[model samples]
Target chain A: MRAGKGLKWVTLLRRVADTQDTDAFAALFEHFAPRVKAFLIKSGADHAMAEECAQDVMVTVWRKAGQFDASRASVATWIFTIARNRRIDMLRRDRRPEPEDLNWGPEEEPDQLDILSLQQESDQLVAAIAELPEKQRVMIERAYFGELSHSEIADETGLPLGTIKSRIRLALERLRHSLS
Target chain B: MITHHLSDKLLMAYSTGTLPEAFNLAVATHIAMCDECRARLASFDAVGGAVLEEVSEPSVTMRADALSATLARVKAQPPVQRKVAVPPKDDVIPAPLRDYLGADGEIRWRSLGGGAKQMVLETSEHATARLLFIPAGTAVPDHTHGGLELTLVLQGAFADEHDRFGRGDVEIADEETHHQPVAEMGEDCICLAVTDAPLKFRGLIPRLAQPFLGI
Candidate 1:
């Protein structure tokens, strides 16, 4: 079943690249659209804008399927990279998105949150994170992975901004030390 | 003083993309020449990737027409290029010194006794912006920042605090930080610097070097 599923996606991608097949496109959309929406929403996007951007991303994927190269990147990575680039561009506009702008304040770092890893590079990073002090690990995750601003963290955890900053600094230092 | 060297905290904040835009810009410029920090940044990227994978997969069935829609769009778009075009060489202004200075800023880069040269990336507008580039085999007069100053080694290595940095090594400095950077035994050393205010020379020779050094 797993192999079949994998084959299905690979075929779907290949066909999407070669023939621009709509049925294949629809299938891909159905699988990824919601996830994309969730990603934007979780990253501080407003509900409406997130939905709009998610649709835009899916449409771009459809149009750009011919650009996909399986050897260099997995379908997920390609899509995620696209999403990230788009998000960065959107953030660079003259007017900023109010909902997406999180403030940076000080707060105590949280405990380590569970991390998911699919790629080997990500796995190495997870191991690196595991080596960090719990305080540093938690702050890093909450600030970066969770998309929470330092200020938000301070407000949420009631920690001083300086303390929060120090924890993150110490955490990065440890992570860098371990990785090195 | 812990030398706010931005604390590892600020560095961590930067790696995680939570830093303020201005601070991020400062650090980004620093990182462009600092390798030790870049490796740490890579690790933070990994942590972010791990978190992304943990999100539960969406449970939904593919609609019959989804593939056709995507395919139709693909037919209309062009192929992606293998690589983005490289920025023009002149546009790739080296960092550190380039950060606070405008692209068209006027300044003089004069060679000192050895290969060391000082060019004021930023003029006398403020007390804090200065940078000195030392070529290979050059020696810089020891000095300290009147404010916050950051040095980023863009090419080759220089030694001061008994540590060596190749390309992309960044050293942050302030009033309390004083070090004389001597270029490695081989190869020219080019460094980009950002200073808050300017330098305060403690010795006569160092004072004489400041104007030419543009410290």
Candidate 2:
């Protein structure tokens, strides 16, 4: 997250980055350190690795606080991005089993069509995706949100894995057209 | 056209950082090549920013020396590098999606147990776009989407309660749609998907392992 003049924390960070204010630095570190650690842990990192990476992320935050852009990215998004990059690097180190490989089942029932529908710019997208029909949404969500593989989605959805894959591909095309 | 599908709602969740790790990885891959999805995600990020601003701020208790310690370290380091910042990508999607989804994309494939292979495709400068590809015959236990479901199939086939779909087919199911699919025949199927929310897992073990599963 970039520090801006108006944002409460951004202002504080800008001051601390400019002047070596131990108190400000500590406050920033203390607030975000654990969250960063937990974020990493949630992304499949071990506790120790998460802690170490969290420290690294915070260190980067310290150095880059002056460059924080409140308009471009939220503090959480910036921190998350840092953590994400770190996790990606860790994942590249070696292959390990990923336990969270299941597929997301289906979209939660839309409470209201108005709320569920996307706005004008996004409306095109929403309409297009909505146009995909129920069957495709089922397969798509199971594979994409549920993180289920075609085979996995098939196993749970009672559909052939190949069928699930084809549906996803077609759904994407329709989305593209709607946006265009 | 790659014909890989990504939903607007899922794009929003992903941009908001609400998606589970597994699905997030897939969306990441599809977004890399699909600019339409990328633009839609940018809008989600904007909405997320507005929403986050409304979220109650977390408690801000902190040690007095935290800032000082952080400052001291930065002061001791070499001059930091600062690159000229560029404006973020647009919110308007491009036309003819294939060009975007077909661009040169690189992803790191990770194998989860039992013949299940996963890869996260990097989509944009923001890393907001992604595509997840899973081969046929892979089995993912029954589960649910975080909020929205979007799927597109490029090759092969899979079946469900409604019917079976081959290449160029699409589906958008909801909480009401719950069923498992096993790949048909010997051919593997490739799908493209995008989602926003994290999956609401079923069963105690899945719920317990949700955190570790990163889905």
Candidate 3:
């Protein structure tokens, strides 16, 4: 089932990339827009802003589809990257002090070895996350979804700052081991 | 060939897009140089995707015309040509920093005495970023940070009490940390540094000049 879903996503992205196919884009949007909205809202965006950001993410996906390399990243990973970047752009736009740090340098083509293991590595990542202890998982969630700094998480959770850092470091180490 | 790297927490913040812009510049610059961290970041991105998948669909749906509206907007704008900056010929500067440095790549350096010169990059208020050129064997004044300070080695190597940081290595320091960093003798050291607050210089001269240096 995972393979089937993954194949469909790759196909839809390719269609959008190769021919500017709106139907394919619509399918992509249907699958991703709500999820992106939820992700943004979880990161502290207002409801309306989350919705708008989600829409903007989809628009960017359509425009940059041609640049997508299926072998390097899964469709969901690619879309999530676009959503994350767009949300950051929106946040930066709202508070107008910072000069945009848009350049992340050249995107490297995925090494052939990495491409071969991409699917298995993703599966391992999901399984590894599921297996994390509840407390560790909570720390990861706060960092990822709440977008809280470690000190902020410490403040919100009443845990010592050192504890938060150690737990997250250990959890990530586990995830890395499992994925490798 | 990076001997030092961003800590896991910083990488996590960077992956989640929560880091302040100045820190983001440092992280991005390091990632541009270090493939190991870049691969690790991709793994974190995969985790992000998994979380997005696991969450129950948002109760609030997008507008029905959202897809069409997006299509219209796409048609209105020309396809984006992502300008991938060609890396400079010499390894002096990384690609991620080229936009800020511009084509000329010249910096107006202010001497920090003892052969160390610095050029501050204007960024957001959250942090101050600067390019520091330390001639071989010169040491920065002993100082502690008011808040957070992240330094990424761009060109050569430097060693503090903590450890030796080479190209692509990042040294994160905070209020509790105090050390003087000195460039290695063989070559000059160039570092891209981001600090959320001013450094607390130990020496009277540096302390007096701190205001003038604007560091």
**Candidate 2 overall Cα lDDT vs. reference?**
0.46
* Candidate 1 CAPRI grade: incorrect
Ordering by TM-score: 3, 1, 2
Give the alpha carbon lDDT tens digit for every residue of A37-133 in model 1: 6656666666667666766787787666655533222355456555554555555411111111011112211122201111223334445556677
Q: How would you order the candidates by DockQ, starting with the best?
A: 3, 1, 2
Please write out the lDDT profile of model 2 over residues B39-112, one tens digit for every residue.
44544443332222222224422234544554566667632444433222322211222334435533344654
Top DockQ model: 3
TM-score of each: 0.52, 0.37, 0.81
State the lDDT at B119 in candidate 1. 55
Candidate 3 lDDT, B1-215, residue by residue in tens = 68787766766667777776678788878877765666556656666776676556548688888878888898886445544634324366676665567368777788887788888887777778889999988888889899989999988799988799988888989899989999999999999998888888999888987886677
DockQ of 1: 0.13
DockQ of 3: 0.26
What DockQ does each listed candidate score? 0.13, 0.06, 0.26
True contacts preserved, each candidate? 0.16, 0.06, 0.32
For lDDT, the strongest prediction is 3
lDDT of each: 0.50, 0.46, 0.70
Question: Could you tell which candidate, 1 or 3, scores higher by TM-score?
Answer: 3
